[model samples]
Target: MMEMFDFRTNNSNGSVKRRLLWVEMESVFGDLPPSGISGSSHNSFTVEKSAITPQECENAVSLTHVGRAGEAQMVDVSPKESTKRIAIASCNVILGKKVFDLVLANQMAKGDVLSVAKIAGISGAKHTSTLIPLCHNITLSHVRVDLHLNPKNYSVDIEGEAASTGKTGVEMEAMTAVTIAGLTVYDMCKAASKDIQITNVRLESKTGGKSGQWSREE
Candidate 1:
């Protein structure tokens, strides 16, 4: 049985807003629960409501990336103070048995697979702003790409980390590194298996900037 959950924010009355965190349930016990199961027994799934201050509500209404009249524009960070910003992202490439063995044995037709991918990831991180419009061009201080082979899952996990001292966060740079690294793996291994799949690209963690630190819970 599988389930899906959707979370969204609902703002009403301009003073307070509620964040709806909904979880869809699949019944394991036939169409319905047997015997004494009643509506009152499922109180644990209730969604809670919270109060939002006026300032916070106003801030939420203003979209930073969109200017007046729904015009898209780059965010102005000139007034923001420069601070140490770091971000990490990850993705996985699922490979077939032949490709997996080839990667594990470092016998891919394209020379060293991981080494070239690492260098490409670093280069991609350094040039993220040029690749994606509206992104601030930041001077990165450090960039690292790590690739780990998961024999149990027949996949390779790529992780990218980027750091910079700038007004904007390096989340885009880290994400770009992970994306290019995954693509490089596919490009190198395509001759062995065209069925290779790259997936689960996402930001794992970020630190510094006005938001401080944030990490995805496992």
Candidate 2:
């Protein structure tokens, strides 16, 4: 299921105005499709349409455009304070034997495929702002990646972990790490198989922040 925030407040005449903010998942499943493991369908959490304050709406609006003007506007971490943050991301790639063989042998032309890609994934997690159009630049303390080969399905699975101490969670970092790693896998294996596909990238869990802990039941 997913958890989201909706900000709302009363207008000058006391009528309510609502804004759909942050559509994020509470938890995600890494298993392949046909098991209802996909990330698209999930539950959501919402606040009442008249519960928000004017200041909160303004803050949210301003936060959305922090880095756009090429200004180094320091994000106010005071209101959010500190909290332990973590996110898990996973993705799968289906390919032929040659692609798997190259991965297994570490003979891809792009150099040490897994090792280099792992580094890239970690770096990407730290620098998600550069890749994603509008993401906060966060200080991530930990990133770990695990790769698995599933011969039965002729696919590769990537799992990533991201942790930090901040207001916003590291879900974006985890998701970015997994995505970059999956893309790297595709790049290295494309020479061997043109039918390669990356699928099911999503956040598996998160801890800390105001929302508390969340994990997929399935």
| Most TM-score-accurate candidate | 1
lDDT of 1 at 212: 95
Per-model TM against the reference: 0.72, 0.64
Q: Write the per-residue lDDT of candidate 1 for residues 15-61, one digit (tens) a residue.
A: 22122222112222224333255664432334334366557876785
The residue ranges of model 1 lying beyond 4 angstroms of the native Cα positions read 1-61
Which residue runs does candidate 2 get wrong by more than 4 Å? 1-78
- In model 2, the worst 10-residue window by lDDT is 18-27
How far is 154's C-alpha from truth in model 1 (Å)? 0.9
The RMSD (Cα, Å) of candidate 2 is: 15.2
- Per-residue error at 209 for model 2, in Å? 0.7
The weakest ten consecutive residues by lDDT in model 1 span 17-26
